[model samples]
Target: MITQNSINQLTYEIIGAAIEVHKILGKGLLESVYHKCMIEELKIRKINFKSEFKVPINYKGVDLDFDFKCDLFIEDLVIVELKAVNEILPIHDAQLLTYMKLLSVPKGLILNFHSNNIFREGQKTLVNEHFKNIPK
Candidate 1:
């Protein structure tokens, strides 16, 4: 039953969890701190997620051994990338997009924990061709 509407709702819940973590920890913390808090928040909310999930690479019908890890892979649907930088750079977007492409995921999120507000300035959601093919 994965649809655009469902994905949107799931995204809302994920962002809410991040907001809760930011509200308590505030800014100026390390990315790992926020990462750990997010894990707890997701568990408390009963959201399914995998932390430090590995992204496999394949080339010419051969699987390559690599250690590309995504910060959070939620419900096998969304790829969540956590950051605690002063600002999100293009490279951050590229990184998340690349993960989404490699995994063939429909949606991805960049959650920056260093912003003033998680809901307002801290989150960026991106979608790719996979998303376009999903039912509405």
Candidate 2:
């Protein structure tokens, strides 16, 4: 049973992992480099995660072939998108939101690795409503 508190704790852990990765690798590297370093850090921290996991697509009840691939699926809990860019833009957040919707996930994270301060400028977390059709 995933809760907001659990999600928040996990988010902190993930951010810590990202900071460790940035500390080791510094900036100006490829996204893959950060991805790999983060994975290593997660391993050292005993965090369970999957990389490049398949996100199936159902089209009118038909499953599509390899529809979407998530960067990191952590404990089947959250989607982690690794970015090696100057800043994380709205499009990046939108992309993660789309992944959360399609995967029927409750939460996601967007982590950028090309920043001087990874914690301050690199992490963005999001959550989606379980029932998204409510009137606001």
Candidate 3:
């Protein structure tokens, strides 16, 4: 079983990679640019992740044609959503939360790469009931 501590460790490493990308690239790049750079960083760090992983939508025992593509799914435990917005928005958080609910993930990180300080102000980590039940 996955533990909260383990997921926290993985997220910590992910944040470090994002910080490194931010330090080297600085702000104001496109979201796709950050996404690609983060992919490389995660690779160098040997983090197991799936990029643009698809999540199928099912409603009332019916599978929908629409699906949600999460930016990154790390260790199949956490979702990493990349953005390059001017600021983190409520909609972004809501989107991540929705993804977590659909994917049944414990936690998620929304990393916006357009901030001057990525670590201090560009990241937000959200959790759900799955997270609450995880062992510390």
Candidate 4:
């Protein structure tokens, strides 16, 4: 089982990658740029992840054909959504939450890489009931 510490470490790794992307691209680039760069960073780090992973939503007991594509699913335990907005918005969190529910993931990270100062303004790690229910 994935632990909280593992999730946090992965978040920090992704945050470091985001900071680097921000440093080179700076603010104002579209979210796609950040998403692409982060994928490269994850590759360089040899981290296991699936980009645009298709998450199947359950309708009743059967798995539906339609799916939600998450930006990044790390180690099959965490979900990541990338954004390059001027500021983090409420809908962003809601979107991640929805992804978590659909993906059956315990933790998710919402990364906004367009901030002038990334350390102070660019990231959020969200934990759901699945994560909380895990034994420490």
Candidate 5:
């Protein structure tokens, strides 16, 4: 079973992978570039994930034919959003949050690959009530 501690540890690993990718690739690449590098890093780290995972949208008890795609779905528990923008805006956070809700996921990370210091200035982790309910 998934636990809070496990999720935290996985997030740490995810951030470490992102940091390694940034260290090698530096900045100014496209989001897709960083995404491919991240996937490589995650594979090197032996982390299970799905690329471009799709989440269906439902409204008024009806499922929509179209779906939203997330950058990375980690262990079926966390969502990773990749960005190559100058900075992470509120809309980015909103987008991740919306994906989390639609996917019924507990946690997510927004990793922007456009900063010299990716850890300090380029990463953000968000959790929802599903995370709160996880056992410690």
Candidate 6:
């Protein structure tokens, strides 16, 4: 079973991987660069994740053909969205939340690779009702 504590630990590791990538690459790079580096980092850490994971859409009990992709789906527990923008907008948060809802995951994170300090200004974590319902 996935408890709140387990999710928290997994989130911590994911953030650490992002920070490591940012530390080596420094920022202002393309989102693809960060995406690739994150993939390597996760592999080095033995973390399981799917890159460019397609989130299936179902409407009215019918599966849609639209392709909604998440940057990273970690351990089937978190949805991580990567960005290389000047700032994190509401749409970015919305995107992550939407992915979380679609995947029924408890946690989501937005990692912007354009800031000087990734842990401080470059990262945003969000959780939904699924998270609240989990055991701590």
Whole-model lDDT values for every prediction: 0.97, 0.84, 0.93, 0.84, 0.93, 0.95
Which has the greatest lDDT? Answer: 1
- Estimate the TM-score of every prediction: 0.98, 0.89, 0.96, 0.90, 0.95, 0.98
In the range 16-36, model 3's lDDT, one tens digit per residue, is: 999999999998889999999
Candidate 2 per-residue lDDT, tens place, 12-72, comes to: 9989899888898889999998888888888999989889888888889998786578899
Least well predicted 10-residue stretch by lDDT in candidate 6 = 94-103
Estimate the lDDT of model 2: 0.84
Better of 3 and 4 by TM-score: 3
Candidate 4 residue spans exceeding 4 A from truth: 65-67
User: lDDT score of model 4?
Assistant: 0.84
User: Each candidate's root-mean-square deviation in Å?
Assistant: 0.6, 3.3, 1.0, 1.6, 1.2, 0.7
Candidate 4 versus the native: TM-score? Answer: 0.90
Writing each residue's lDDT as its tens digit, candidate 6 over 13-49 gives 9999999999999988899999999999999999999
lDDT of 1 at 99: 96
Error of 3 at 64 (Å): 0.4
Model 1 C-alpha lDDT per residue in residues 60-84, reported as the tens digit of each score: 9999998889999999999999999
**Residue by residue across 1-136, what tens digits does model 5's lDDT show?**
7899999999999999999999999999889999998999999999999999888898999988875799999999999999999889999999999999988899999999998888899999999999998898
What is the alpha-carbon lDDT of model 3 when measured against the actual structure?
0.93
Q: Which stretches of candidate 2 lie over 4 Å from their true place?
A: 131-136
lDDT for residue 127 in candidate 2, whole number 0-100: 78
Better of 5 and 6 by lDDT: 6
Better of 3 and 6 by lDDT: 6
Spell out the clash pairs found in candidate 5.
none
